[model samples]
Target: MKAVVFSRYGGPEVLEVRDVPEPKLGPESVLVDVRTVSVNPVDWQIAAGHLDSRFDVRFPVIPGWDVAGVVAEIGPTVTEFAVGDEVIGYVREDSIGRGTYAERVAAPLRTVARKPMNLGWEQAAAMPIAGLTAYQSLVRTLRVGPGDTVLIQAAAGGVGSFAVQIAVAMGARVIGSASDRNHDYLRQIGAEPVAYGPGLNECVRALTPQGVTAILDMYGGQTLTSSLDLLSDESKGRVVSLTNDGILEQGGTFVFARPSKADLDQLTRMAESGVLTPEISTVMDVTDAAEAFRLSQTGHVRGKIVLRVMGRLSAAIH
Candidate 1:
């Protein structure tokens, strides 16, 4: 099988496509003939050796976690899927080495979920990590509900975009922060756009006199500290941050959004009903993993960056 690997982490230039051995199917895993994989910030950060201390790394590491494909083979103990089930997964193993930046991946049954009928392979690939993070942060960490007003930081980015839609679908009025260019995009997804910066608090307060009932911070530091000012009440409103742990010092929750098959299923159901739609910013061939990583490092991506590992001609959803 052909896969991208890095013998030593330095930059995207260190990544190269090479022939590698096929992964053996474990009793609790499924072998997916990968159709697409999406790029997350962690992908580039790992490739750059930033997470070396956190995860045990073996040389020639393949970096990626989000995968969407068909099951080519199933493990002996696996009962939930079969020889040809369409699935999407967050394929994060215990350590680091084998990953989804390849033609196939041995995904644990616990990480796999049925691909929603309405989503394409690329969109399915885009949903796992980013969608799950947003869903868990809002639904699990904050418990956002109807009649509530929620503010999402970096709301036009990968997880933020999904967070905005999920909050709106849950009946919370959403206020999202982004540059003016993405403000209209935020509005289309149901979030009232607030230009991100010094005036964010006043902008959000202008919309709701009681201030926001919850806050989902994908960008930490100033972005988060300032958002806390918009909380309706410090004791009642909830806050969760994906980036900075300094939020914990400020009485906000810091969530890592652990991968869960159950949570992925709920996201799939929402996508099937047209409530959650993943936005794809760029699509490239699997061989172009380096270029895709370069795009991700810029941090200007509007949504998920996907790699088409199979059937690469399909158009990306705007």
Candidate 2:
């Protein structure tokens, strides 16, 4: 099978497309013939050795976690899906060598879900990590709901975009912070847009005089610190950060997205019902993974970046 691999820690330039052996399927996993894979910041961060102390890494690592494809084979103990089932998965294993950046991936049942029929390959691939992160942070952690005004930092980015939509669907009024360029995009997705940077708190307060009921911060450091005072007294503990663990010290929660088939199914249902949509910023061939990683590293993309693995013939057949 052909896949993108990086032998050493560095940047996107270290990535290369190469022929690798097929992934070994586990008893509770299924082999997916990958149609599309999406780039997440964690993928490149791992490749750059940023997560070395956190995850076990082997040489010649394949860096990807999001996959949308068809099941080509099922494990002996897997009964949830069969060969030909269309699926999307967040294929993060206990280790970091084999991944979803290839022509196929052996995905455990816990992380795989039936793809939303309404979504294309790219959109389906884009949903897993980003969508799950937002869903868990808002619905599970903050418990956002009607009458609550929620502020989402970096609302135009991948996780932020999904966060905005999910919070809106849950009946929370969403205030998303982004640049002026993404303000219109934020409003189109049901969020009241606020510009980021200095005075971000005031901008959010201007929309809701009493301060927001909840806050989801995708960026940490100054971004998270500045938004702390913008939460209502009753909602001060409702803040959640995806990138900062120091949030715990501030009486807030720090979330690391976990793979849950139930959560993915809920997201799939939302997409099928037209309540959730993935914003794809770019689509590149799998061979150009280096460039795709570079694009993701820029930290300016509006949404997910996807890589096409299967060609047109396979796509048409499915």
Best by lDDT: 2
Which ranges of candidate 1 are over 4 A from the true structure? 234-237, 311-318
Q: What is candidate 1's lDDT per residue for 1-318, written digit by digit as tens?
A: 778889998888998877788998999999999999999999989988888888999878988999999999999999999899999999998799998988889999889999999999889999999999999999998888898889898899999999999999998989998989999999999999989887888888888878888888877767777778778765343888888878887788888767799999999999999999999999989778889988988878899999988743222111
Predicted model with the maximum TM-score: 2
Tens-digit lDDT track of model 2 for 179-279:
99998999999999989898888888888989889989888998788788888888878999999899999999999899999999999999999999999
State candidate 2's TM-score: 0.97
| Model 2 local distance difference test score | 0.92
Which runs of model 2 end up more than 4 angstroms from their true locations?
A: 311-318
